[model samples]
Target: MVFKLTSVLALVAALAVTGNAQRQIQGITFAWNPDTPNGSHNLPKNALAMAPISDLNSKAFTCRTNGLNFPNIKSYSSTGGEMFIVAWDMNALNSTDGPKLNGPCNHWMASTAAGTDNLKWFRIGEVGYSAEEGWCTDKIRREGQLVVSMPNDLLPGEYIFRNEVIDLTYAGKTYTDDPTMGAQFYADCLKYTYSGGKNPKEVTTGLVSLPGAYLATDKGLLLNLTADGKPPGGKYTVPGPALHKQPNPGSA
Candidate 1:
């Protein structure tokens, strides 16, 4: 179980709508199934009851024309639930022009704090890398055979495997008024519609895209995710369902 962050290809094409690469976020959507039975493989009630847990913010990974190494990939498990992973492409921040591909998106590590230790670990292979805008700053690519792994020992709740792209109306501070990320981007959380051990090709064809809504965020997308991706436990969850339903059978 290697929960790595290798997404982009599957969802970016989801949006048929086009936008400027700058100012407006372009080509991004939740890679989801369009045929799975609704209410099936829903997130655990508790997973939806909580807020997204993010320990870090505004990270950038860049790769140069000469190709750079993404040597540091890190992750963290929150007390709230869900393990958050982050790493740097190093190639992201170098030039506003963007990254040079056909290089390395190295295996990486991350830390809970800004130091050499306490950083969580993970691995990635059987994949390639690419970039747009800023490989690290704008949007990046994890070319062909993209598969990000998570620890098999994940908590039994709703989880999302997607990147967040926050957009702030730089009214004055640009981002200060809104220190937000993932303002608008789809989460293929529905992909988790089934169990987590199989290859994505095995179970995700007709499943509808799960609205990036967290079963937690009141915005929407609240549902159940069985430990086995089945129903009953596959029931839908409403806001604060976990508030009264304590000690639900889910985590991660």
Candidate 2:
């Protein structure tokens, strides 16, 4: 009886650990160099709070940078060799929302000045429902990190890198009006100063706003992943302005 009780206890402990592991995602923070002058990256005070649909245009629950200089500001090589590492936390009961079986779609963008104003931003790149992240799978999986490279000819100036992840599993709840079905939006901005570009043009053209950038009925945001047929059976269109064209540093 004693041996049987011990085995049962061990099995229970193993299951508990597995449950906890599934809740957490990896790379929710920027990977800064330890040798750099800037310290570790810090999330805004209200980073964990959820922003309502109405406040999408405004800097609703973004990092509260009141009177604070840019934290985790870093420099990047203009020759197009460097890559930015973006991460997120996805434990359901934790701060940010968890990934749905079909999604956790990602949209990354950038702007010159700092502020939550959507009008000042443009698309850099985006990743829609991905099979690598276990989209549409039966088990709970974490979509944690991404690596992004800037255009070689990117202008030299102060810029803000904005990363947005939309949880579409619970989307469509509100439908056409405010289709956020229980959808959750997670976003973070990192600051940077660039130099050494060959033909750096200002990124004022093709600007897009956050709330204005997406609609409730956008194909990528409102689709039902669990339907009997194959999930997202067509070319996935990332909602927003066209990708800005950058000159090649090598061409200069």
Candidate 3:
């Protein structure tokens, strides 16, 4: 009887640890890096709203238990530079489904980290935002007085990827919360103006990671780290540095 009791206790303890570990990953938070609209356009300086996305267990969405299992992304090149796989598959939850950005700004495609004076954006996925972090450690340069945005028609706008979402069943109550459904992405977007780089890109941080064999995907950048249940910025691999350049105004 004593041996049997000990075995039962061990099994219960193992289950408890497994359950707790699962919840730890479920609790993921995200941050928005803010910036202004244009240079003379008086764009805000490093602006962000703080989306704080927490994807708790919701039987409604029917998301993969192994977290968001994104499909293999695709990439292409055109006048718009290079459009990499922004998201695996996406479905909006509501009107603000596009960007899911911080502050009130949502619609954007490419953004820099230095500041917003040289920020540029495009349209893909939805309007606002998704889990995908736009333009990772990237470079953007602007010279002309003209505000550099997009093609002959693409305007500087921000929207969210919100559509076909349902209420999250939390604590026995259906919360009509909108979290953009799509595979996360990261971009290596670059912008250089005629004047070269009088304008600087914006820089900011987003989202918190969890412990254990971790994984992250953004456009072309992918990171696989082990937190061992540690806090943010805890010993991690140093993937090759971000894209860099020295604006050759002489080429002008």
Candidate 4:
């Protein structure tokens, strides 16, 4: 009886862990197809139980779990200046699981390379904190969506668009102090193809590579979150490269 009870308790603990780990990108509502969007057809593949990829050097930091799962490989066509609604997959009971409210949410894009390794990525949109809406994560939780705008002057080609949320709740400590006690990164990506634009030029500047774009010691990632759900000093800089400015920025 003692052994059976111990096994049951272990199982319960494992179940709780699994429930907590279900935060990931589920589907993206693209401009072309709102009904059958990016990950809607691929249910489990898009909604994987991926934990935060803390190590900046890890390849999973690029796309988290679906980095290499390019089975469908179909690109949704788009122009630019469109709003893409991204949904997070979480356990029903724990819908508001992670990507803490004090952090920033960012969007990135990379031209399709041979593989998902070492591709150059550039930030397209980001929101950290504002007196109007508070933290971006809070807005994300309230709306139950992460909205990203496609660049207005992006060159015509296939690209991998990604959405990422950096949880800075415990970023006050360095990874050197404790491996799992620093910032947490959660991201997922899908493919898109751009066609016509106002004056589209290939993104040449402000491109950064994953695993190298962010560092554990960066000023933006080392701040401590206060009880008010903001970093100390009441200032926060969104990490990653600046959004490349095009000629004519359009409406979302």
Candidate 5:
């Protein structure tokens, strides 16, 4: 589902004309500080300012050509475990449909290329609906500090760390008539370069494309928060290609 620029512009225009209220959704602005050389002491003050446009397609967002600017590739060691954390801003504006939905379901992925336009992406991890808590409550609980780790065996190269949150609270029968079918997506792409891994083989399987990577009808995308017959133990099948298994950090 490649979204054309005109289509995106049209959607934005429609939202503007309809006077849709914007909800404040969380976003990932910083890489794991501990993995960086100087930690938080040297991190940028306004990381979100460097982020690409928040939209359905990851490639539509901007990328630093020089790869040395603010929010550029933050180096991490493949041997040592590291993670990227979402820096939430309670004040950031989002679609009104988000809060009405069932979740802050987190979807995280990595790609060897810089932009998501026609790029092959690999799923890293996902946190979907939980059965222990009710719908609205779960959304609020998952809104803070969403985190995902870089595979320890990832081949060293320039890569984009893509973090996405899907709100499905409005996915039930009541919202079937809604143009978006009550699905809201918030995505962020951060630049990164991995080094110090023993494996030299590149990961080639389990590749998927963004926009096309997810379908609104996918069970994980359109969920019934209050239904008792949901997947056992609330386990979710994230809507994307299977996670590519890279070799362990020290593997030959």
Candidate 6:
């Protein structure tokens, strides 16, 4: 689903008028079902709170609510090549009390039994700033969801997937004034079993831990979304490990 510039501008104008409020991940769908029944797959641990993690060094940066052992949350069945759609509550754009997401979108995955090794969580991909298309959050606000592709080359095993959005609307500031005057980190994870894949990578290189992945002063975090107005394109670097690539069949 693509949106035009006129429509995109309209959304930005509306969001500007409505004001900002932190929103939460409502639920996740295994496939590309935007209208899928709401609550079919359980909500994220912090769905009711609707708060963003300001401190990037805390354990909550790992999974928002649960640390390593995220138990009792409902698990879903997923196969490689399927679409994972993360649905957000309607207030993201409709109500005046929703978030104005103006930052990057990132997702990661790790083996369920990978122990405490932070390097096991490999970055899948990231969608960041675009001079012509606007921020990734713009797309999310337009559709009210963030869609990611399940890694097709991943080994068949129990895995946890995380979808995250960094709200940079106030990233250029610090907590000196208001505690909330900084970048907002919102992340959620879901457990799933994989059945089809061609790789058995347990600990891939370049993986990074969530709590240690970002810093308060990282160039990506301390950014002015308005400074780079009309661009040949802004120099917005995504903060995290490099995007994961499947190792060759028998090389690693």
Best by lDDT: 4
- Judged by lDDT against the true structure, how good is candidate 1? 0.23
Assess candidate 4 and give its TM-score to the true structure: 0.78
Tens-place lDDT digits, model 1, residues 135-228: 2222333321122234333233333233322211111121223444222221112113213321121221122212211222332122222333
For model 4, how does the per-residue alpha-carbon lDDT over 162-206 read when each residue is reduced to its tens digit? 778887877888776778678888777777667856677777899
Native RMSD of candidate 5 (Å): 11.4
Which portions of model 6 show Cα errors greater than 4 Å? Answer: 1-22, 32-49, 66-75, 116-119, 174-178, 227-235, 246-252
> Which residue pairs in model 2 clash with each other?
27-87, 27-88, 28-87, 28-88, 101-136, 118-209, 173-181
lDDT of 2: 0.45
lDDT of each structure?
A: 0.23, 0.45, 0.20, 0.66, 0.46, 0.63
RMSD of 3: 22.4
- 3 against 6, candidate with superior lDDT: 6
lDDT of 3 at 46: 19
- Put down candidate 3 lDDT per residue, 168-214, tens digits, no spaces: 11112112233443222221122222112223333232211111111
Please, what are the lDDT tens digits per residue for candidate 6 over residues 40-86? 35353433345678887667777777575543344455446555556
Whose TM-score is greatest here?
4
**Better by lDDT, candidate 5 or 3:** 5
Tens digits of per-residue lDDT, candidate 5, 1-252, equal 112434322322222211221322223322434323432222233433322222333344322122313355454333323544444433233334333334544344455555534567777766655566544324444443444555765666677666655555455522335554545554555666666455445667777665557555666656565554344356765566776663454343
- Arranged by TM-score with the best first, the candidates are 4, 6, 2, 5, 1, 3
Cα-based lDDT at residue 164, candidate 3: 14
Where does candidate 4 have its weakest 10-residue lDDT segment? Answer: 1-10
* Candidate 5 TM-score over all chains jointly: 0.60
User: Could you arrange the candidates by lDDT from highest to lowest?
Assistant: 4, 6, 5, 2, 1, 3
- lDDT for 34 (candidate 1): 19
Of models 1 and 2, which has the larger lDDT?
Answer: 2
